[model samples]
Target: MMPMVLDWFIGNETCETIKTKSSDDVCQGDSTCYNVDNGSGYRCKCLDGYQGDPYLPNGCQDIDECKDPNLNKCEKICENTKGNYTCLCPKGYHGDGRTDGTGCVANQSGGSLIIELTVGLGIGITVLIAGSTWSYWAFKKWKLIKLKHKFFRQNGGLMLQQELSRRDSSTETAKIFSSEELETATNNYDESRIIGRGGYGTVYKGTLSDGRTVAIKKSQVVDESQIDQFINEVVVLSQINHRNVVKLLGCCLETEVPLLVYEFITNGTLFEHIHNKNKASSLTFETRLRIAAETAGVLSYLHSSASIPIIHRDVKSTNILLDDSYTAKVSDFGASRLVPLDQAGISTVVQGTLGYLDPEYLQTSQLTEKSDVYSFGVVLLELLTGQKALCFERLEEDRNLAMYFISALKEDRLVQILEKCVVDGAKIEMVEEIGSLARRCLRVKGEERPTMKEVAMELEGLRMMLEHHPWVNNDESRLEETEYLLGEASLKIGSNGGMNNVTYDSITDHIILQVGHGR
Candidate 1:
């Protein structure tokens, strides 16, 4: 084709001095090209919003603003174009949808507005529910704290603190435990931890944080009228430091009823050992006498050795605990009374176990040290005969073991009434002496009963005599045979010629005859 040319360069040497250039050699697909110096050379420039090797095919692509919303300054939506992008509003909004400008706004008058209101209401409900749950828990915590404080004050916490503060620093005192500490220790007072229950309270076994095992007694009811007396008991128990008395470790008052913590005795009650058929066979006469002496020693200490005299109003076999070594530990001081130094006796309502109650105190309502003696005599009778202080299965006249024992002794039938196990183990003389001591203590008049000190001494003497004196024919096998024959033949024999039937004298003669014959 013929081309038209124009010459502007002075006299135009026919424009043959200018060089030719192709578009592909000068610029890329995404760039525009421009010639300089009459097509001698060219320059390339990328289009707006496109970058990265524009000279290569498929290199310079669309800049996707949606990938990074901040790049497009979009508030609601961003749509990418070939080489640029645009920002648009969402379905529920209206505006340019640019964060740098007037961004999306609520439509305010259609289905879009309804969608916005629904989302806002859901958020509000969630917040309200969370706030209500938090408040409920906080209120419960506050009420619990308030109740604990009320219980503490009602249980005479302030008085107990003052009493403890008045004592010397070196003096051993009981700990004042918090309710929470005890609750956690006992697993919220689980039923499995319960070791015993009585008329006064239920006892739980607990392990403290310091690893001490204790028995915690929780009273059945709270009596505001007896708060002072409860405090007094705490004080009195804390002062007692005897081996035979259970140790009062602490107390918890942050409950409606007070809780007392005591040293845990491993073995069961003396009643269990003395009454249970399986356990009774294992208790030797020496062990039984030692237990008796130890119990008597503790009562003596409570009556005379303690700083204040304590009258154990309820004395029974059930109240006597035994440790692993068979050491006696007197417990359940719920009905204990403190006697002033100047007072000879405390006149109060008669409260004690039925079978061990003192007839004199029961009649006069006068409680004294001698009343304890009477109760101890009942315990002695139990040890000697292995019979309960009161038994319904017995004949009417023999229902009361104390009266039955007295009647048997008066009729010289002590050998027949004595427990076969006790008779088999103890010498006849030792058993007779102990029975005599029990008879003296069981005297109906309080004045005639021996003091606890004298009782303790007498028991101790008997135990010493048993330990030292070697009775003749101490063989257990022979003793068992003698007891068996006595049980069988003595009943059939009549009180005819030489000796009365089943008397201590006759039993002694039978034993002598058995030993003489080497039977």
Candidate 2:
């Protein structure tokens, strides 16, 4: 078919055309133009690395190739002029950066030697730094391990191991724990794990890898002079097996001050039960009597049953702990003394709670089994009256509960000073008997106080009597009978003076009125 024709009218003429020329028909030499196809126009374009319109004179000029990374193949440096680009080697390089020549090469003499020396020095410095860091870390790790070993040896680890080896294999042995094991157990000795603190140390609660909960007692101060004594105590405690005494399961000696681990008791201390208002109400007369009996039994065993006679120098309610079942577990032997078979008493520093301290032992600086008996007597007073052994809250004359108890008994006012729970729960006769027994124990002379075994037997008998004869009465005649049974010898006043003004009749009247108001 013939191409379509277009007609145009100029000022004075008319024309008809069947064809038209486009720029694409005249494009040349590294320049190009594309036809519009619609017949309106065409466009011109230069090849890569060149810029300008291809239809104009000198329009397709050479581009400065150095400005673009893709167009330049220089190894070191590139330069550009008005219409061309050049690749040149940088200083210290021998060859031209061109396609026909070596791109870049090191100088033959001094420059190449300098480059080699610089690279070698850099590698040496890197290796030296790496070796130094590795050596430093290795030395630190070795020093730490050596320090731990030294501590283990210094804290009597070898002695403890030998002692354990000498014991019977059938019996449970006290474990020697590593510092890491205990640290992991107690979360690195976290403050939250602290269960108790005292003059000796802090006690932390820990759960071992074996899932057993334990109480770890860490000493606050270390006396190098007492290392022998400390190890001896460990040996003695490990050999002891009693239900009333807290069990020493293991020890960690790598610490600055040695740590002792015991089976954890869920319930708090006996002092807490006796002193805390909320917990006091729960300690009924029966529970208190039972606790007293158990504590006495433990002291008796320490005095007589153990292979060595151990005098518990600090025997107060706080040292006695209770489990979930309220069973007694005597702890804290930091001040205990081991007595020889022939020695009657150990003369040493007077160390004990002020209120429960034996006046004779305090004056003479002599510790004995009777000193423990005296302390136990004060604990009995605590149970009967729910009063602290030494409470400044009371009137000046009645600050010391032991002295106050003796004064009350001497004036026949025991019923007035006794705990309300004890009054309501126990027979007046049993209370009187316990009071007389306690009076005998608080004698100023250690020799005058009954033996721990004797005290334990008396408490046990009272417990058995209360359990078997629960229906016993609290009649006035029985009260008189109990008072007479005490005898003048058991009630004899010691150097510790008594209160004179308080009478039983007046205190009884006051208590009767108080009881009446309560009802």
Clashes of each: 0, 0
Residues 49-143 of candidate 1 have per-residue lDDT tens digits of: 77766557755656676787566788778888877778899776888888888999987678776776899989999999999999998999899
User: RMSD, model 2, all Cα superposed?
Assistant: 14.1
Per-residue lDDT, model 2, residue 139, is: 99
Q: Model 2: which ten-residue window has the lowest total lDDT?
A: 510-519
Question: For model 1, what is the error of residue 235's alpha carbon versus the real structure, in angstroms, after optimal superposition?
Answer: 2.1
Error of 1 at 361 (Å): 3.6
Q: What's the true lDDT of residue 422 in model 2?
A: 92
Per-residue CA lDDT of candidate 2, range 1-519, in tens? 899877332223111111132324344456765544434445557876678867676678879888787777777788885556778887677788875568878677686778889999999999999999999999998988888888888888888889889888897888999989999999999999999998778999999999999999998877777677778888888778888999988898887778999989999999999889899898888888889888988888889888889998899999999998899999988788898889999888778888999999999998899999999999999999988999999888989999899888889899999998899897676687788778888999988887887677667656654564341444544544543543432322112222111111111112110111010
Name every residue pair that clashes in candidate 2: none
TM-score per candidate, chains pooled: 0.69, 0.68
Residue 263 shift from truth in candidate 1, angstroms: 1.2
CA shift of 305, model 2, Å? 0.9
Q: Which segments of candidate 1 are over 4 A away from where they belong?
A: 1-129, 410-412, 470-519
Clashing pairs in 1: none
C-alpha local distance difference test of each model: 0.79, 0.79
